[model samples]
Target: MTSGRDRLIEAATRLLTESPDREPSNRELCDAAGVAAPSLYHHFGTKEGLLDAVVDRAFGAYLKRKRGMLRTGDLVADFAAGWDLHIEFGVQNPVLYALMYGTRATSSAARTADDRLRKALHGLRDAGLLRIDVDTAAAMTTAMAVGCVTQLNRERRRADDPFATAMRSTLLETVTGLPASPSEPEFAARALVAHLEATSEGFTAPERALFQQWLRTIADTTRTVQDGQHQ
Candidate 1:
């Protein structure tokens, strides 16, 4: 059996997102959550707390799907995966999505999500894959993503559709300066890694090991001169 807190969150997420047209009353939430009014109050303290939890639960779900994907050390691919996951979440949970984002007010959850995205953008900058600074890249990518999600909500289109995929691809290429065609930097890096692995490049064993290390440093772009510029 789900805990009261969990049930409340689940119920709120479903009710709010499934029918933005209808506001769920406390009585409705209590019924849907299978909890008494006292239980809701005891768990959340108040209606505001319950609403906040609903928003948190919504974003938490998005991040959960994003984390499920494997990390290939391919920044571009990782970004694309994250983008797809974001769209999927918005499409699947339009009511929850609109509640969280339709307003211009930035909640703690929204800032947290943006910070997470900024970290990914910074990784791309470190990889030499970005034409702009990490902050600019993060902002541009985020703005585009928000715009796309808002459109998806109103247009009522599945994120899996070709139109959504094209928007993702076009925006990614435009912001990161990565190729919309082939020869993306990540692909080149992977190809180079394979070549070095196969030929050993006429270097000593230790040298080849260090060479791989260098490649990782470049791809990771983790430690840069101005890494402090971003969080």
Candidate 2:
């Protein structure tokens, strides 16, 4: 048996998909759900509350499928795949995506997606692949991705639009400095630090921490010089 709450949710979802251009009224939703307006207020407190529930339900399903994605150890590929998945979700569920991301409403799934991006960037940082700090990389990547998806959605384009790929590659290249020249000593230094941290066993905890710090400082200094030279 469908509970009134479930029925209301279904009705709202249907109205969202069908109307896409307008907000369905409480009366419309109640009539569609075969429930009274009081029931919606009783269950959700307000219309926005009901909308939040719908977004959570939809975004949660998307996240579940994302969690099932196979993890290849290649962090770059994993990051690309995740970006594509996000674009795919937004393109497929334009109404839901707009509600969750384009509107003022908050969604935990959106925050979880941001967390996942930061975690992926951290993995790249550990591998000496990121040229920028994790926080900056996350912020730039998120902005680029959201902008790309918003454009695609606004233009009613497909997920496979070339703009999406171009934006992804551009943001990633800027973030990771991919295809680094062999002469970049900073890369070598960071890589060495990562390897030592992963495999070396003799150092005490404080010693290891200090050693890692020293290596990162040298690498960061070298990187600053390289940036200056490029300009």
| Each candidate: RMSD | 11.3, 13.1
Once superposed on the true structure, which residue ranges of model 2 sit more than 4 Å away at CA?
Answer: 179-231
lDDT of 2 by residue, 1-231 (tens): 999999999999999999989989999999999998899999999998899889888877777656744443557756766777778778888888888876623567678777877888999999999999998998888788778888998998988697887787787789887742322355345544644554457888888778877877776677567668979
- lDDT against the true structure, per candidate, is 0.71, 0.77
| Prediction 2 global C-alpha lDDT | 0.77
Off by over 4 Å in 1: 103-108, 182-231
Sliding window of 10 residues with minimal summed lDDT for model 2: 179-188
Q: In model 2, what are the clashing residue pairs, if there are any?
A: none
Residue-pair clashes per candidate: 2, 0
User: Candidate 1's error at 9, in angstroms?
Assistant: 2.0
Per-residue lDDT for 1-231 in model 1, tens only? Answer: 789999988888778766778778889999999989998899989867888878877776666655544356657776776777677777777777776775522767877888888888778877788887777777777777778888876877877676767787887787777755322343334334544564544898898778766765554453232244445
- In model 1, state the lDDT of residue 71: 53
